[model samples]
Target: MRNLLLSPFTLPPPSGQTRNCGVTEVLCEACDHLGWKKPTKIQIEAIPVALEGRDVIGLAETGSGKTGAFALPILQSLLASAQRLHSLILTPTRELAFQIAEQFEALGSSIGVKTAVIVGGIDTMSQALVLAKKPHVVIATPGRLIDHLENTKGFNLRALKFLVMDEADRILNMDFESEVDKILKVIPRERRTFLFSATMTKKVQKLQRAALQDPVKCAVSTKYATVDKLQQYYIFIPSKYKDCYLVSILNELAGNSFMVFCGTCNNAQRVALMLRNLGITAIPLHGQMSQNKRLGALNKFKSKSRSVLLATDVASRGLDIPHVDCVINFDIPTHSKDYIHRVGRTARAGRSGKSITFVTQYDVELFQRIEALIGKKLPAFPTQEEEVMMLVERVSEAQRFARIEMKESTEKRKRPKAGEEAADDGEQSSGVRKKVKGGSFRGRSKRGR
Candidate 1:
C-alpha cells in the first residue's frame, strides 16, 4: 500500500476541484444538475489524467465515485467526437452493468448521449437491436459482450475510442478472463483504456499490463480500511441462537433501513421468510431467484417498501443503494476481501452507518483474518441475553414456519408446472407438515448444520 497523497498522478491544486476538472461547459452544467459539488479523491486524480488522454488504472474503494472518474472524461471526449458506440464499459455483474448505464445516461443527458445495457438474463433480440442502432456508450458484462461481439451482425468495436473495465478484480474473479481476452483482441488497440478496481491483485496487474499502455496508477486507499464514518462491530453467539440475536438487533435498530448479508442463497431466503413471519418487512435477493424477482427485491428495499434486505454476495460489490443505515453480516464472509465490500454498502457518500458481523465459535479464524486485512480489531456489539431470550418463542414459531415454507418452495421449484399455483396455496392453507424426504423437518441447515 503506497502513499497516494504524494503520488505523481495527483492533480494540481488549481484543477483538483470538480468545477476546474477541464470538462466542457455542457458537462459542467450536467454535473451541477446531478448535484455533484466537487470531485471525489479518485475522480480528482484519475479524471485529470484521463482528460490528458492517458490510460489510467484507478484503485478506490466501493462508493468512492469511481464511475465519475472514468465517466466524465469519456463524456467529454464523446462531446468532441460525437460517434455512436464510442465507449464501452465492462462490469462483472448484470446489476452493475445496468447501474453504470444509468449513471452514463444521467451524466450525459444534456448532450443526448444514448447508452445501452447488455447483460445476461434479458431479451437478446432487443439488445441486438440496440447494438444495431449504435448507442454512444455500451455497458455490458464481459461474457454477454463477447456473446454479442461473436454473434451480432454489423456490430463491432473497431471505431471505439474509450474502454473501461469497472470492478476489474471482480470481473476476473467471476472467470471472465477469457472473455476479456477475446474483447481486447477484437477492439482497436489504439483506444484509451481505464481499469478501476478496489484491490490490485496479481490477475488485475497482469491484465493491466496486457490491456493498458503506459497506464498511470491513481490509488486512493493504500490499505484495506472501512470508511471513517462507519461504526463496525462484531458479535460472538451460539449457532442455534443466531436467529434470536438477529431479531434483537433489528428491534434495537428499528426505524432504519438494513442490508443483512448471508453466506448462501438458501440461508438468505430462509432468513427473509423467518423475518417476515416475525412481522419484519424483509426481502431476499440472491442468485437462485429469477432476474425479475431479484430486481423486485432490490427495488422494494431501495424504495423503502421493505426495511430489511437479506442478500448474498450478489449485492456486496458495485451496487450503490443509498440510505442504507446499517449492514448486518448474518453470515461472515469466507474471504476477508468480501468483508470490505459488504460493509461498504453503508457509510457511503459521506453518510454515517453501522455494520455488525456475527462471529460464531467456528468463525474465529475467519474473523481474525478479516481484522488483519482491515488492519484493526472490531469490538463486540452489545446484546442483552435476557432480551434476546424474550424473542425466542416468537422466533422459534417463525423458524418452524420458515422451514415449512422452504420445503414447499423447494418442492415447487423441483416440480414446475402450469396451474399448480392454486393447489400449492391450498396445501399451505391446510397447514399440514408432510414429512419431506432427505431428513428431519430441517432440510438444509446453515453452515455447520
Candidate 2:
C-alpha cells in the first residue's frame, strides 16, 4: 500500500475553500469588499452545486442569500470559461434584473467580466449598445429581453451557454412563461439552465420540467421555511386599532430599519402617512409608483436614512434589500407564501431580526392558514398598556358610532312630523326648518311630503 505524504511547506486552504468551508470564506471576503459578513443557508448549499455546472433548483425563503447562491456560481463560471459571451440571467422584474446585475458587478470586479443589464424601464438602444461590446453575462427581465430579441437587428444569444431564471416563480406569476419559452427556443439546446425561486409552485415545477436537465434540487429550509434568526411574533388587535398598535410598537423599537408589508397600495400609503405623522421616516413602495420613484424609495431605504418602508406584495418579491432589522405585517397576507416572503425580508443572510405581524380578528383564518403552511404557531406579542388603552378607546369610539348609526337608521324608518324636521337637521332655533343637505335633505323631503 502506498501512502501519500503531506508536504511541510503546503498548508490546507481556509474555510469554505475546502469545499467544507462552504460559502463562509467567499462571503466573508466578498462582504469585506461589499460590506456583507454572512451567507444564508440557501447560498451555502446552492453555490457548490451551481459551481459544479449542474442545473440547480433552489427553494428557500426570500432574502435568504438565494440570489447569491446562483449568482456567485455564475460569476465563477464566467471567469473560468474566460468567454466574453457565455451566460444570460433572466429575472421577472426590472428592479431584480438591475439588482442581479449590480451584484455580479460587485463580485466580479477583480475578474473584469463585462456584464449588461436589460430591463423595460430603460431604453433598449443602450442595452443593444452594451451588448455590442460582447459582454460575458447578460442579466435581463424576460419581457425586455424578448423586445430586444425581436426589434434589435444585431442582438443575438447564439454564443450563450448558461441560462438562469432568478425568482422563477415570480417570473411565471408575471406571465412571462411564453417569453421564456420563446427565448429558450433561441438559445442552444445544450446550454446549462438554473431555476431559482423562494417557493416552488406548480407553474414553477412545469417551468423546471421544460428548462432544467436532470437538475440538482436544493431546499435549505422546509416548504414554508422560516429562518431561525428571525423572532416571529403576532399581535392580535382589532382592525380599527391597528394604527395605534403600530405607533406604539414603533415608539418602543430602538430605531432599526424596518419594512411594513401591506396588501394594497392604498394601505401602504395610509400606513406610510400614519408613520410619518408619528415622526417616523416611512416610505411606500408599490406598483403604482413610477419606476423612478420606486428606485428612489429603495435607494433611500437601502441608505439606512429611512427607518421604515411600507410596501405591497409586488415589492416583496425579488427585492434584495440589506440591513432590514424588522418586518411588520400591517395586513396579514391572503397568500401563505406571501407571509413567508414578507417576513423573510428581515433575518436575511443570517442576520438576527424580528418580525411582528399585526393580526386582527378578521385575519384569524388567514393567520391560521399561514401557521399551517409554516408548520409552527406564531407566538403572540403582548400589547403594551398604552396600546391596549388605545384599543379600548377605539372600541368605545366604534360603539359610539354604531349607536349613532342605529339611532339615525331607526329615526329614518319612522314617519316624521313637519315641525320635527328641524330636529333631524340638528337645529331647533326659532321653529325654522332649514332643509338638510344630500342624504339628509331626502329624509327631510320625506317628512315635508
Candidate 3:
C-alpha cells in the first residue's frame, strides 16, 4: 500500500539554520552545531514515524542523509533501554558497515552507547572478543556475521530488538540472500526492521515481507528523482581510446581528486595503471582485492594522499569519502541500479557536485537502459574542443587508413634479357656463376656486358 501520511514535499532551498523538531534535544543541538538545519525531505517524513518504533522502508537517494533518518530513531530508542546491543545493523560492504558504526558511535557517544563493527578485512578474534563484551549495537556484513554466529560459541541475538538493512539492494546483489535468511531465522521475530535503498524492486519487496511485519513504506524519491545539487554531463567516445581520454580530462581539471567508476575490475585496473603511469596518484578498489588492501586503499583516498580512485560498482554502495568534488563514470554501467549508485558517490551531504559519464558506441545501449530505468534523460555535455582534438590525435592510422605512395627498388641490379627466360627458369647449380653455358648462348651475356 502507498504511504500517504504527509503532503508530498516539494523541495525548497535548504535554509542554513537548524530547527527544533523530531530528534532528541542533544541530537538537535548536534545538528545545529553541524549546520544540519532543516530535515532533508526524507528525514522530515521518515524520522517521526521511525522514532515511534514502527517498521520503516525508506526509498531515497544515496546522499539524502537517510543514515540520519534511521540512525536518529535508533538512537532515540536506545536511550530508553539499558540493555546491551539491543539494535543490529547489517550493511552490504565493510566500508559501509564501518560508516554506519561510525555514525552510530558519533550520535550515541554522548549517551554512553557502545557499538561494535564486524567485517571481513579485520581480525575475526578481535570481533569475537568485542562481542564478548556484549555491545549494545552490532554492525556487520552478512557473511562474517554468519561465520561469527555459527562458530562463536554462546553468540546470541535472542535479546536483539532492532534490525536495519542498509542498502538492501546491494546486500541482495552480492548473493547475501541466503545469509540474510539465516540471520533472520536466528534473530527473534519480535523485532523492529528498517530497509533502506535508493530504488525498490521485487527482491527488496520480498525480503521486506520476510523480515518486516506490516512495514510502513516511505518513498522519498522515485527512480527518476533528480537532485538539483548535482550537475550531470555526458561525453561520447570510443571504447579503445577511453583511457587516454580520461587521462587528458584529469589533467585538464584543476583538482586531481576524483572517483572514477568502471564496469569491471580489469577495466578499473587498466585505468588506474594508465593514470599512475602519467604520475597521477591512482588506486584500484574492487571485490577481488583483499579486505585489508581495500581498507588501506580507502584510507589513502580519505587522507587525500591518493587523488584518483578507480573502482567498480562495489565502491558505489555504502562507502563514504568526504570532500569529493567529482565522480566520473569511466564506463557506462550495464545495470541501471549501478548507474544511480555510481553517481551517488559525489554530491553527498548537500554539497554541490558534478558527475560526468563517458559514453561510447558500445555503452549507448547501456546508457539507454539506465535512462529508461531512471525515467529521465541524462543531460549530454558538448565535447570540448580539447577533447575532440585529443580524440583526433589518438585515432589510429590503420583505422583512418589513406593509401599513399610506393617506390620501385633503389638498388641497381642486372636486368634479365627477354630471350634469357629459359636460363632464369633453371635453378642455380651449387651457387656458382654457372657462366650460363656461354651466357645461355648469347642474350644473358649481352645484358651482363
List runs of model 1 lying over 4 Å from the truth: 1-18, 419-449
lDDT of 3 at 282: 72
With candidate 1 superimposed using the best TM-score fit, by how many Å does residue 112's alpha carbon deviate from the native? 0.9
Candidate 1 lDDT at 139 equals 95
TM-score of 2: 0.78
Looking at candidate 1, what is the lDDT of residue 300?
81
TM-score per model over all chains? 0.89, 0.78, 0.80
Q: How many backbone clashes does candidate 2 have?
A: 4
Runs of candidate 2 exceeding 4 Å displacement: 1-32, 35-40, 385-449
Indicate whether candidate 1 or candidate 2 has the larger TM-score.
1
lDDT of 1 by residue, 68-158 (tens): 8999999877655577789999998877887888888888776677899998877889899999989889999988888899899999999
* Candidate order, lDDT descending: 1, 3, 2
In lDDT terms, how accurate is model 3? Answer: 0.72
Looking at model 1, the pairs that clash are none
Best by TM-score: 1
lDDT of 2 by residue, 266-325 (tens): 667555644443345678777766566677778888998778888888777778677888
Backbone clashes for every candidate come to: 0, 4, 2
